[model samples]
Target: MIIRREHAGDRPEILAVVKAAFPEPVEAKLLRELFASREYIPELSLVAESDRGEILGHVITTRGWIGAEKSLGLGPIAVQPEYQNQGVGSALMNATIEQANKMGESTLVLLGSTDYYPRFGFVPADSMGITSPDPSWGSHFMALPLAAHKPGLHGQFKYSEPFNAL
Candidate 1:
């Protein structure tokens, strides 16, 4: 298996993997909107491919804001049903984090499984002074401070505009 940045030609396969990973179409629909939104960061969109060149999973982090400071919003990371628990999601996540660090990003935030994301060094957002757009998310809303993280980077997190429509 291989992990790499997503290409324009990978759209169909990415969407298919996302749709198959979830029971509802909400995530897939959100991905479509993110792709067309200005907040879409091409470099942050990544995919995991099998040795046979089949797409196995997908992950994306779009431009967002932490108060007035720039940040990243990670989401819709999905692996095909058969690919779950096989480290595909982990590979995509590690790649995303490495790339974000390479790009000098401050932080990456997301609403994800507490069990899974913690393994990636994600901690409760509020603990880092970052508040979720929805208070109801509580601890599930997490943040991973990157190599460029600073002590003063905190405030209400505002996800990309397309996320507001959800």
Candidate 2:
């Protein structure tokens, strides 16, 4: 299996993988919208592929602002249904974080399962002074600093336009 950055030709396959992995259209729609916008960071969108060259999973990071601090936010990491629990998602996630770090993004935030993200070093935003618009989801929102010993980053996280529309 190969973990690599997405190329121009990978767009359709990436969307197909997301559509197949998720039940809601919101995930797929947001992907398209983000790609269309100039804000899309090509280097942060990645896919995990099989040894035979099939995309097994995908992850995307986009421009986001947390109060006065600039950051990257991860989303819609979808592994093929048959490939779930097989480490494909984890591989993609690890690669994504590394790529984001290379791009100089200090932090990565997301709205996801609390149980799942903690394994990747993500913790509640409140611990870092980050707030979500939906108070009910405060605990589910997570953040991780790319650099372990960096200065504290704190603020209210404002998701991308596509996320806000949903």
lDDT scores of the candidates, listed in order: 0.95, 0.85
RMSD of 1: 0.6
- For candidate 1, write residues 1-166 as lDDT tens digits: 9888898899999999999999999999999999999999989999998889999999999999999999999998999999799898899999999999999999999998899999999999999999999999999999999999998897999999889999
Compared with the true structure, the alpha-carbon lDDT of candidate 2 equals 0.85
Instruction: Using TM-score, give the best candidate's number.
Output: 1
User: What residue runs in model 2 are displaced by over 4 Å at the alpha carbon?
Assistant: 148-150
The list of candidate 1 runs beyond 4 A from truth reads none
Looking at candidate 2, what is the lDDT of residue 85? 96
Which pairs clash in model 2? none
Clashes of each: 0, 0
Clashing pairs for predicted structure model 1, backbone only = none
lDDT of 2 by residue, 1-166 (tens): 9998898999899999999999998899999998887668888888898889999988988888887778877897999899999999899889988888777787888999987999999999888788876778978998888874255677788877788888
